[model samples]
Target: MARYNHPEWHPLFAGYASGPTPLTTGSYGQLLYVTEFDGAPKIISEYFPEILEPAPPMLWSHAQGAEINGIGNPNEVRALTAPTFGEHLDDWNEIKISSS
Candidate 1:
C-alpha cells in the first residue's frame, strides 16, 4: 500500500468557538474548513491577515477578503461562535507537499 500525502496544508484544529489566533504583526494567507457561522457543515473559506506594527489590530482588517468556493464571496467576520466548532479542537499538523 502506498501512503498518500497532501503538502501545502498546515492543518490547525482551532474551531470557531475559541477561534484561531490573530497574526499580531505580519501578513499571511489561511484556508479554513469552518463548520461554524450558521450551523451548516464544512464551510471552506480563505483568509488573508495583514497587520503591521504600531497600529492596533482590528477585526475588520483580519476579514478584509475571503474566497469561499460554491458560495460566492460572503461577508466575512472576525469570529464565529458555534457549538459544533467547539466539539473539535485539535493540535497543529504540518504536512508539506512534495513532488514525488
Candidate 2:
C-alpha cells in the first residue's frame, strides 16, 4: 500500500519479496547545511544538539588560503564567514541532474 500521494514514484517502489530484508545503520551521513542565514551559529547547533557537530563544511572560501587537506591556494583567500555568504542564497538554483 502506498502512503502519501507519490503516485509518480509508486511504481519505483518494489517489494523485498521473499528473503529477509538486508539493512545497514545509516552511519553514512546526512548533513543539513544552513548557509546564508543571519541566525547565531550556536542557535543551529542548539536546535539539533544531538546530530550537528561544530565542524564547518569545506566552503568555497576554504579553497583560497585555508589549509584544506593540508594544502592552500596561491591566490589570496576571500573574506567570508559562515553567516555571511559570498553569494546570495537566491543565486543558487536547484540542480537535479540524475545519473540514470
Candidate 3:
C-alpha cells in the first residue's frame, strides 16, 4: 500500500512476494533439550576462542624545578605587577610624594 518514487519498484515487490516461514518443530525441540544437557564446554569454546592480553604501562613526568626550553615551564613564570603597601597618612603634609 506504500507509495514509491522510482520506476524500479515493480521488480523489488515481485522478489519478496513469498513471505517468511515459521521455525520447524524439530528445531524448537532441539533448542529446549540443549539447555538441559551439560553444554558448558561447547558454549565456552564457541563464545571465546582466544585468551585476553595485558595493557602496557604509562610514562609520567617527575621533574622537580623549572627548565624552560621553547616549551613554557610553570615554575619559571613571574607575576606582571609585584604587590606593595601604600603609606598610612596622619596629616595632609604627610603626603611626601608631590601631587603636581
Using TM-score, give the best candidate's number: 1
Model 3 per-residue lDDT tens digits across residues 3-92: 112232211100001112343211111100001124231110011101122111111122322221221111121222221212111211
Q: Estimate each model's TM-score.
A: 0.21, 0.14, 0.11
Give one digit per residue, the lDDT tens place, for model 2 in 23-62: 3121211112111234432111101112233222223222
Instruction: Give candidate 1 misplaced runs (Cα > 4 Å).
Output: 1-33, 36-40, 53-56, 59-100
Whole-model lDDT per candidate: 0.26, 0.18, 0.16
Q: Quote the positional error of residue 92 for candidate 1 in Å.
A: 18
Task: Kindly give the stretch of ten consecutive residues in candidate 1 with the minimal lDDT sum.
Answer: 90-99
Task: State which candidate, 1 or 2, has the greater lDDT.
Answer: 1
Model 3 residue 12 CA deviation in Å: 7.4
Alpha carbon lDDT of residue 20, candidate 3? Answer: 28
Steric clash pairs (candidate 3) = none
Clashes of each: 2, 0, 0
TM-score of 3: 0.11
Candidate 1: RMSD over Cα atoms?
16.4
